[model samples]
Target chain A: MRKLREMLDKADINQFRFWTQIFFFALFIYGGWWALNWSERLPVFACAFVQDRCGSCYLLGLQHQMTAPVSRMFSLAGLGILTGFLTFLIWFVLLNKAWCGYACPLGTLQDWITKIRSGIGVRRSQYSETGFKRLKRIKYALLILLILIPLAIGNTIFGSGLSHEFEIPFCMICPGRTVLPIFNADFSQLMIDFSTSTKMILTALGMAVTGGFFVGAFVKKRFFCLFCPMSALQYLLSRLSVLRLVKDGGKCTRCNNCVQVCDVGIRQIAENMEKGDILQDDCMLCLKCVAACPENDCLQLKFLNIPVFRSTDTGFFCRMEKKERGI
Target chain B: MASEEQSRMAQSIRMHLAMETEDVLGRISMDEAPQAMGYFYRKLRQFFQQPEGLGHFDKPGIGTFCAQVPLELIEAAGARPVRLCMAAGIWDQAGGELLPAKSCSVVKAMAGMAASQLFFSGVCAVVAPTTCDGKKKCADLIETMGIAVHRLEMPPSKLSRAARNYWRESVETFMAQLQGWTKQKITRKSLHTAIHRRLMATEQFRRLCRLQTKGVLRAVDYFLVTQTGFFDDVEAWTLALSDLCAELEARVAEGRGIEKQNRPRMLLTGSPVLFPNIKVPLWIEQAGGPIVTDELCSATDMFHDAPAYDETCLHDMVSALCDRYLSPCVCACLSPNPDRIRKMISLCRQARVDGVVYQTFSGCLSYAMERNAVAKALADEKLPLLYIETDAGFEDQGQLSTRIDAFIESVQAKRRNF
Candidate 1:
């Protein structure tokens, strides 16, 4: 057991996280697509088994399909949607928003871009606190539009013929819908849809969002993850996650190690003195803060109150040794 | 005669001769040292002269510099605590190779001693505090020599409760590491015993400082008694100091003091003046002014406060140790170090000194930067203050003597005006 621990200590966890991101990115976008008949039942999200769909956006599409021929009235899902929400909830709680840190292909690609920029000796851009606060509000607005636009189309509140353009509204502009399908050798998304001027404009907007955010991700760490609507949805279920990052504020030296290492630039991890449940909304649960903290038991990765890898003075120095080696 | 027995006897005799030569050389080099220091040298010589095979009582020793290290914790872990200080000599060449030219001589001398295995021989570990940049890098340099250095880090500022808890945990972690190294358990009972032992020594030191201020004790005796405690056993040193304090009390009642000619009393503050590195104190005494009290880490500042003991709890005692030691330290490591100036003023008021000598080592920036604040505080009290920056070597003696003599004259003139 001790030798196993020594081996694990030698293994670079951040690099391990990088490979995990690649595996999930492959599995979600391209895994078993050729052989499987699991399309209609599969829930839609950027990370779900099906491509070109999102769970929330799919809920909107299902809402549209179910209510299109009836009177103008909003309708909710039956048993299948309930089961899909449960499945998504299970995956969401298992890693929490580690989906953002270690699984999101977009976030992973952004990190890769950051690495490339760092390789070319370019410094990162940091947003001021107020500016970052303003940026944070964008994702919630996107999340609200993702819900409201589909509801408007299902009820014909925005009028009947607008369904072609307004159904799956965020997916029309989502970079993931355009960018992720290419890994499966799908390039049909890149072409602008010419069905209507509105469809052309939505496809054009998708292309623009993809191009802008990819460049933004290259220059800033986790740039697109900051404004991801999916991340905003995941945070609503964050409190139920059993896999948690805990902080012993009494032991924390306010060293700013956690903040310095956080991909999302979380200040609460360092500045918080209150003891219970510091799993803040912006936390990716990357546990980079755990790796960086020098104090013993100061920051911890706990799964249902059992420690997996907690912070240690030796582990901190070991991570530093690995960082130096990487440099 | 048995041939193997005869050869073994011959080897033992040769080893003894080498030990004797080292002692003689150390004494001859420090032959110009004060009588009290020579007395301490002889006691240390006797203590270090024990043969091997002494059993668990002679556990592996851990050497450290700053008084912030809780020696009792080291004791509870079953390791002997040895205080590492700047040894007297011009042995700078080896340390000069390792340390930057701008580094303080005390750290340089420490590097020299560790490099040669001179004063630092037979030590299992060294605990060095990051009190200054020079000291921090000195710890690193010593670690390069394969000496295990446990760097006891303190917060840059001690104003917050978080900083206090951080320091307390750091001390606890250090104690745990020591326990692992020594294969001993640091029980609550043992920690209490250790705290009790140190409190006794602290009481004796307090009395010693009190006597020195009252002009009942000589300045050389004050420096010697406290400095020698760095090497002496805590119990024996306390008893020795208690006895001396009693003798001095009798002498004071009889109106007997070493000074036939009245010297101006000055409070010594700033960089530590270890034995053999006693040029500053030696100069002050020789120039018709005696240091009545000191704010140095090695002197009265270390003993100013005893740890607040809670007999039933180990964590409380550890917190008390952190509070007592880290709180009063005037080291520049703590920013906006107003506590230091406050401590100096309070000690000066009690000691009733005519002037304050704010001493700084050449590379010790923390104490060096405090010159303005110390000067301002002393000026407000209308007390004369002299700033002296020197190194470990004797090359600065002539210049230092001239400044001390002038400061003494000015302080005397100020007294005459009064």
Candidate 2:
């Protein structure tokens, strides 16, 4: 067991993450060819629009559950909603935000775009601190609207409402709805729907977001993750997750290596000396900070408060040397 | 090529250094001292006994005044980095004639060495980080002595984004200057290799620190091992340290540690305690207190923080190097540095030391100003602290020893009451 841990501590985190991302990308995107059906409520961006997908994103199920009739909210339908949430919670607690980092199909696509940009030697862009502060709130706002709009469409709220087109408000604008289906050789979701004005507007918005996502993620890493409503929802229950990103403040040197490598520009990882639990709302639990930390046991990925992977000088040098050798 | 007067002066300085080195060696020598320590002891003796023949690097030497200048950059440029900070009464006296009497002894000794041209003869150029006023002046002093000097400007504070970017740019500028001086273009591969070499040495240093905290290695031995790294080849120093750690580990396994269980473990902070000037540490040990660990920039802090870069790109690696050298530093020269106090308290807690001994060279105003803050922080933690103000001179050794004994006795009483 100790030998396993030593190997893990010195493992090349980027290689591990790259292969893990590819494995999950294959499992979620192409699992149907093997007749594999995992679940309908995996808390990642496994789009329901993909007909052959093994599982659907929990947000889609959540929106459908919220659009139930008001009278059914207290009945078996309500129990179904509760059970579905518990299932999502169980899946979430197993990996926390790693679902977004390693399993999200849309996230994988964005990483590929980033690789292309880096290959071309184009400098990646990061948001200014003020801009990041302002934009980080958009995810939460989208989360609120996704829940409330679905509820309003199902039942009259503050008067009258009748528009089923707004059923899954976030999914209509989410770029994943249009982008992920391309993997299944389905380009049908790329067009703006002309059936009705409501469908026309929502589908047009989706098309625009998809275009923006392509360009934004090319120049900026993890661009779509900035406004990902699923990320916002996951953070609400982040405290209950068994998996955690823990910081030993006493051991941290505040060298800013973690901040420099963070995809989302989370500076608090290096600055916050008082906090033990370092998982911020924007953190995807990618363990990049742990990989970048040079101090021994300074940053750790702990499950049940036991360190599974912790930062060490030897681990840091090994990873850098591997990168140097192009391994 | 040397004048008769200059040769006589060099001879006098070497004699004084030999006497001081032998005195320190005599005090630290014991029957049970680890055999691995002979390497460090010989290195220290060679440094003083043959100052002219020290630092035999295959590559040209680049002198660095402070720890802020990244050694990896120099190594990447195919030059060896020789840290030139020193502390000795003879050199301080020589430099006192050239500078104001109120300058710190460290800067004074460095200026004295530069003036004599004994140490800087082999160094092709010097990179001086403007960490404090005295060092900024010392850079001028070294330049006046006809040695090439590059001033690496350090930011006043490291907490702000502007400060971090400024430091990165400064480091880049220094890298360019070093490349020009060494006439070697620093490629990504070379930089990565340099970083790896230093990381290996840093790992070994940390292991030695762990052994010291375990009471298997003595404090003076630890200081000597680290101080020898100032001029020794990094790989060689690392190998010797590895041997020392191995021997110490065996001793620990056999339960033959050097420190007595009843001795009060102390944490040393405030100012860099260089070699041949270890009076405070020696007095602490003689007063029944063992320095298990320290927060000195000249020793443990120099190698404690290694650069951790994510990408292999040169831009990302250089940025990581810049932050590694700047952000973690708890130097008293940096303003608005609450991290220093926090670090001192953290070290005390980690080492489980009975007390803290804060030593400030008499003319080191920066560390002197931080004494009250350190005392207040230690007081809040309910740990005893002793603040000593002296210089490279030996006039205050008796007084400092008396104060250290009283502080240790008080700590023992406190431990007993608890």
Best prediction by DockQ: 2
Could you tell me the TM-score of chain A in candidate 1? Answer: 0.86
State each model's CA lDDT, in order: 0.68, 0.85
In TM-score terms, candidate 1 sits at 0.52
Give me the TM-scores for chain A across all models, comma-separated: 0.86, 0.98
Kindly report which residue stretches of model 1 are placed more than 4 angstroms away from their true locations once superposed: A1-327, B1-41, B44-57, B258-262
State the lDDT at A232 in candidate 1.
81
Relative to the unseen true structure, what is the C-alpha lDDT of residue B191 in candidate 1, on a scale of 0 to 100? 73
Candidate 1 at residue A170, lDDT?
75
lDDT by residue (A1-327, candidate 2, tens digit) is 989988999987777888999988888888888898888889999998987788889999999888887799998779899999999999999999989888898998998898888887677887888899999999999999888888997789958775888888789989988988888899989999999999999999999999999999998899999999999999998999999998888877677789978988899999988748888888888888899887789899999988999998778877766765672
Fnat by candidate, in order: 0.00, 0.57
lDDT of 1: 0.68
**Residue A322 lDDT, candidate 1, scale 0-100:** 48
